[model samples]
Target: MIHCARTDKGMVRTNNEDAFYLPEGEDKPLLFIVADGMGGHKSGEIASRMAVEEISSHINHSFLVRGSGNETMQIIKEAFYNANIKIYRTSLQREECSGMGTTATMALFKDGRVYIGHVGDSRAYILRDGCIRQLTRDHSLVWQLLEEGRLTLEEVRCHPMKNVITRALGVDENVDVDLVEHEYKKGDIFLLCSDGLTNMLEDKEIRDIILGAESVGAAADKLIEAANSCGGFDNITVEIILVD
Candidate 1:
């Protein structure tokens, strides 16, 4: 496995509210996470940080006890649930963090398959055979509209409410998480990113950049650079995992 990740505050945001986690060393489990937070003051930053930390801890502990098995999806779902409860409780205890929430996108690689747990608008994509396919759907109002056929793809891109996500961690005690499983082979590349990247570049552009890059690290750097070149109105984060 080959992997790399990057995060940037972008051009407009005063501070980055995005956070990500990537396991280090061969002894670590193959897991990756990205979060985009929302709230007042620095609450967004705290929320995102808390999310990645909590989820990673929970998943790690689960693997230690249960071992990776068919229950992997359930373990990931429970991790998200626990992270949501922790973030929500903190929001109620602190004024600045009130209503704080974050988008959580987690990918767990195990036994020739990837299990994805997603909430809010952060995304997961697979690049295989020179094509890119989105693995998770956006939990945003604009996405709902697009699914309902009420809005076109072009309109959704420029919609004023595109940033308004319908679901997020820490916003409520219970959150609906989307879980998916996909098989992977040698040369398959998986990407997990915050909306900051997609909001700036189209899927085709992302596929092209990943294909053109020499390494996973270079692909991450080029993706961030390309998003920043597009004005970078929001914090950008990207994680690339290549199956070797």
Candidate 2:
């Protein structure tokens, strides 16, 4: 497996609230994550960082034992649950961090399959045979409206409440995480990113950029550059994993 990741504060944001995790050593389990935080002041930054740290720690400690597919999915769920509780508790204990929350999207590769755990508007996608498909749904009001047929895809692009996410880690005492499993093939590319990238570029635009790049690292750099060129309004983050 080959992977690359990038994050930027964007052209407008004074501070970046996005956080991501990419495994360093080949000995480590294959895990990647992207988080976008929300709140006042620097709390959003703290929330996102905490989410990545807590989730990575949980998975690193618990993922060593091999298990069935269902068991692995359960492990991923537990990692999210544990991180939620930690972030939520921190929000309650620190007045400055009150109401702080973050979107968490993670991909864990195991036994030729990728397990995804998601919350908020961040997304996970798979590219195979020169085609791209979204693997997770956005947990936001506009997405809900779009699903209900009350809003069209074109409307979602400029909706006033497009940034209003309905579900996130640390906002409430409990968080509902979405889980998905996909079998990957050689040469397949998996992407996990924050809305900063998606909000600035359309799906087709993203697909083209990745397909056009010469390497995973270059693709990540291009994605961030493209988002910034499109008037980056928020922090941008991208993680790309190529199965070999």
Every model's TM-score: 0.97, 0.98
List lDDT for all candidates, in order. Answer: 0.94, 0.94
Q: Write the residue-wise lDDT of candidate 2 on 82-133 in tens digits.
A: 8899989999999999999999999999888888999999999999999999
Instruction: List ranges where model 2 is wrong by over 4 Å.
Output: none
What range of 10 consecutive residues in model 1 has the weakest lDDT sum?
61-70
- Among all windows of ten consecutive residues in candidate 2, which has the lowest summed lDDT? 58-67
Model 1's number of clashes is 0
Residue pairs in candidate 2 whose N, alpha carbon or C atoms collide under 3 angstroms: none
lDDT of 1 by residue, 1-244 (tens): 8999999999999999999999965777799999999999889999999999999999887864345555888889999999999999999999999989999999998888888999999999999999999999999999999999999999999999999999999999899999999999999999999999999999999999999999999999999999999999999999999999
Q: lDDT score of model 1?
A: 0.94
Which candidate number has the best TM-score? 2
State residue 51's C-alpha deviation in candidate 2, in Å. 0.7
